[model samples]
Target: MKKQSIKKTPAKTPVHGSKPALARQVRIIGGEWKRTPLAVLDSEGLRPTPDRVRETVFNWLGHLLDGNWHGVHCLDLFAGTGALGFEAASRGAAQVTMIEHNTPAVRQLEATKTKLNADQVQIQRSDASTWLAKTGAGTARFNLIFLDPPYHQNWLGKVVPLCQGLLADGGLLYVESEFALTDSADSVLPEWMTGWQVLRADKAGMVFYHLLKRQ
Candidate 1:
């Protein structure tokens, strides 16, 4: 019997209705790893910065970073998804330490570090306030600090002073909260936050983001 030859055809692309499901990931908006997606975990108060907000915050720090974050130390107090720290590392930060006490979130952050092979990034499974209290300014001072703790839990009040003390001269601090801190005179800042001043502020939905600088 003679054998017959069969032709091969390429697989058809799935239609819109059969599109692949989107991954639960947040992307790096700028720097070398732009658009690299980091997985998001199921954890309480794990809100990653929205792309627009992240872009705005980086743009505000453009002059400070001067296109490179080399030699800069950064701290993400409530890392959650490691978005802020990873973004800082991608932009050339010398060291980016992220602190998250939640078990699942810490695992997620570790997974991201492994996936990115981010030598500059460090994930610490510790409470934000506890870490701040233990680390004195002499021990570790950061050029940029991210204070996006779980909203409405008074975490800011607990860590603001510690973070301020840990900021180097002319260091920048980025804060995100549930309500606008600029809404009223009393809402501006606590009495001890005298050396810090808001450089930029904006609102996206209920979130109020601020970029502050230490004198």
Candidate 2:
């Protein structure tokens, strides 16, 4: 009798229309929502600022503001997971407007806002660039602006200049980029970065986070 042959089954692949999994959760490291966890969506290029980085950044801000977040108006250009914006709100920022173009991400932001009962938070569903362009200078100015757009898209070049007009004098701008903004021979500062001074900067893995103030 001939031996029977067996067939092997191929591994199952993710269905095309299935929803993406929740990537992970990041907690508010300080303020009213301290230790509160926010859900992060598994979207391409979505990088939530790590907890350690945020703690350092906020420490820098706290020192600058003398530990006062009152009356601070913040704009999160690429609000991704609402980590930065919400953090600002948690710290008592007067207002926090979060810009997110992705639908699911926007939904999550709304849900988080509702959960926190954060009346100071505002969720806007629009592309950051378009929103900035439509928002006239002097009409709105934030004491702190968070610019953590997706990396390597020249988003800094496009939005940094616009942020100049939206940033109040003596305000702070927190940025996360793929590379350090430097004037060294190997790495030169982009033209848009002119007129800004890097007050504090540190690196975590491949992230080059900086806190800047306009000259």
Give lDDT tens digits, candidate 2, residues 84-145. Answer: 99999999999999999999999999999999999999999999989988997668889999
Q: Across residues 30-89, which tens digit of lDDT does each residue of candidate 1 receive?
A: 888899988877567788998888988888887767876887999998998888889888
Score each candidate by Cα lDDT: 0.84, 0.93
Off by over 4 Å in 1: 1-23, 183-189
Q: List the candidates' TM-scores in order.
A: 0.84, 0.89
Give model 2's TM-score versus the native structure: 0.89
Which candidate achieves the best lDDT against the true structure? 2
* Total clashes in model 2, counting residue pairs 3 or more apart in sequence or in different chains: 0
Error of 2 at 60 (Å): 0.3
